[model samples]
Target: MTSVNDQTQIEQETGNTEGESKDSVKQEKEMKPEESNANSPTELSKLTKIVKHSKPEQPLGFDGFKKQYYRYASKFGTTLNLLVVGGSSLGKTTFVNSLIQGSLTGKKTAKTSDFMQHRLRMTDGDINFNLTILDTPGFGEKCDNSNCWKPLANILVQRLNAYFENEIKACRQLPIVDTRIHGCLFFINPTGHMLDPLELYVMKRIDRFVNIIPVIAKADMLTPEECARFKRNIIKDLQHEHIQFFHEPGKSIEGINYGMPEPFALIGATKGMQSDSKNAIRGREYPWGVINIDDPQHSDFCAFRNFLLYTHAEALIEKTHKVIYDALRTERLNKLKSQPNGFYTSSKKLVEEYMKAELGRVERSLRQTVQDKLQEKENLLAYTEKQLEAKHKEYEESLINRCNELKSQKQSLENLVRSDKTKKHSIFFK
Candidate 1:
């Protein structure tokens, strides 16, 4: 009996030993994987498995982007960013107000102080583009015993520089001056045949920046022959100054006159009228004729708009891009100039060093700027997506509610129909 009992105890002990061994093996198996993972190089562990199974996200096509751009651009199209700059009292504001057929008493004139900007839209047509006319305070205005050209030029340069930098930087902080400045409509008085010294100075400054379109504003003050002669003289002067102008193809140099054609319209405070009646006079003796822009049939403003649309569209777009680039370069030069004392003792040496260092710096800066902008865009897109999702959710909820209401109405109608059928059957039976 004792032998049998000891044998049983040994068997029980063996079974217990086997069970403990199995548990140890299972624990080790689990620990081995964890140990291996922990021992593995971090980078090696991070190597993503190339599962060639997922579909790629589709990208928007060029046409899609263009369609999107066009949608936004359509809203901005009529808003022509026109900077009317010339010598004082040349009727910059007058011409602007006249174009939009608005009074210069409060809103228009008040908006224009020292370099005022006003957005004007045509009340006549839905097809008309919005015009944002920037009436720069008349250059050469007398202020505190000084001609304002120097200060104005300085201000203009600064503004130009800022505009250029913002464009290049694509800086969202600055107001976008629609890099598409269609035309610089330079207002000149026909009476003042010769360019004033200040005018000459302004013209030279303008030549550096934009494609100047000289418009003799008070055209009614001159005869057709006199207007032609004046245009020729002005063109000659501009050419002498080495200014290149965009002239219509096949249009001869003699025929290449600035400003829109025919019965030049003018807006007065009281009434507007066009004078097509030929002035029976010579150069200075021509009557100053005025025309209301309200008369769309005879309005020179319409001609101006038409000219911009058909003839100068390409020139304007091209000029805008050039202006943006020029502005950026000028700003960069100004920044370099404004650097602290002895920053560039020898320009040549500094330039060499800058050349060596700047390419890398610019590359890095560009990368960073692009990344920031892209991230911002991405954030905006994400926000927009969330908004859309919320809208969709709300719409879905509303649809569900409407469907429930419809279902309830349907049930009620069915109940009514059944009740009516039962009553008719009962009546028939009776």
Candidate 2:
């Protein structure tokens, strides 16, 4: 009976151990799938979903990237997109080339025959821009020629549309391009001082498209009195048409001013290597007042390049915004005005309220944007301060370490000298 009981107990223990082994194997299989899935790239997709639905992580750490971005943005905050347009031989090509090459000498490479459209690109590190210089056919002498003015105007309109279409689309969701016509440099010869009726017609047509900047080219050919008279006359004519001018004094370094009815006085091109014209005048200047390639300062073209890049970019952005706003406002007003009397009166009221609310929202958004920019500036300043403090601390620590090392060396030297003296005295006394 005892022998039978022992065999039964052994069988029961064997069964129990086998069951435990099976359980352990099942547990390992269950955990293996989860462990493999956890290390899979597909797991990132799940994390992305969670992040999308959750609050964004705050910006962390100030570094070179942040500093560089802010520095570039601040420097180019008012970058303008400017389109230079005018009759041929009016120094449009020369002025543009000079501006880009920083001197009239470099404009030698530009083709100046008839009307040709040329595009130039300028870049500073990561910031890149293009200047489209449309050399429109000269209009005054050929204005009445239907073949000339009509085709020119049509082409101008089409090109203008295409240019703006591309610009608007590219900047549809960006903050970089904000202003159009940051300024215009319209080249008109001062020697003539007479407005070509054809030029005037073209101006009227393009005026609806862009802001006018009446630039008096070849001012060096005109006497000071003549320059003054030309400026006044141009200003008077522009004012008569209700056009405004933003002027910069001949040698002023002030921020550019906008929205004046009078034409600004700018000597777009000058003659000779005179100090006044070479150093003070901001635009491209030619040697001996020639708008041709013989000028030497032509190689220093970066200044003009910078000007075009800044102005063109700003103007493109501004103009785009204006176009959008105008279109929306006009469409809304037309729809409201088209309604029949008493028809959908409640709808009209609701629409008006909605428009007003949208306008208010835009204004509030602008205010909030300004506040955010200010906060960003403050953050940048604080970051710079912290960096400076860290550098200062590091320098102080280095200096302290250097002083301690010198102290240790000096003590070693002093001990060596004292020992040598003691040895000499002991020998002498002995």
Each candidate: what lDDT?
Answer: 0.54, 0.50
Clash count for candidate 2 is 32
What's the number of clashes in each of the models? 6, 32
Q: Which residue window of length 10 is worst by lDDT in model 1?
A: 47-56
Task: Give the least accurate 10-residue stretch of model 2, judged by summed lDDT.
Answer: 47-56
Q: After superposition, how far is residue 283 of candidate 2 from its true place, in Å?
A: 12
TM of each candidate vs. truth: 0.46, 0.42
lDDT of 2: 0.50
The runs of at least 3 residues in candidate 2 whose Cα sits more than 4 Å from the true structure, single-residue gaps closed, are 1-82, 102-115, 143-156, 159-184, 191-194, 243-316, 323-430
- Per-residue alpha-carbon lDDT of candidate 1 for residues 1-430, written as tens digits (9 for 90 to 100): 2233343354354332233333322221223343456655553332322112111233323347667766665555544466677666666777766655555342324434676667755533324456666677666556541334344434334455545445555346644655334566777766635545556656665455555667766665565577667777776777687764534444424564434322233322322333456532111112454444444442345556555654555556566556544654664667667988614323334334544563476568779999999999999999999999999999999999999999999999999999999999999999
Task: Indicate which candidate wins on TM-score.
Answer: 1
Model 2 per-residue lDDT tens digits across residues 350-428: 4445446645765697799999999999999999999999999999999999999999999999999999999999999
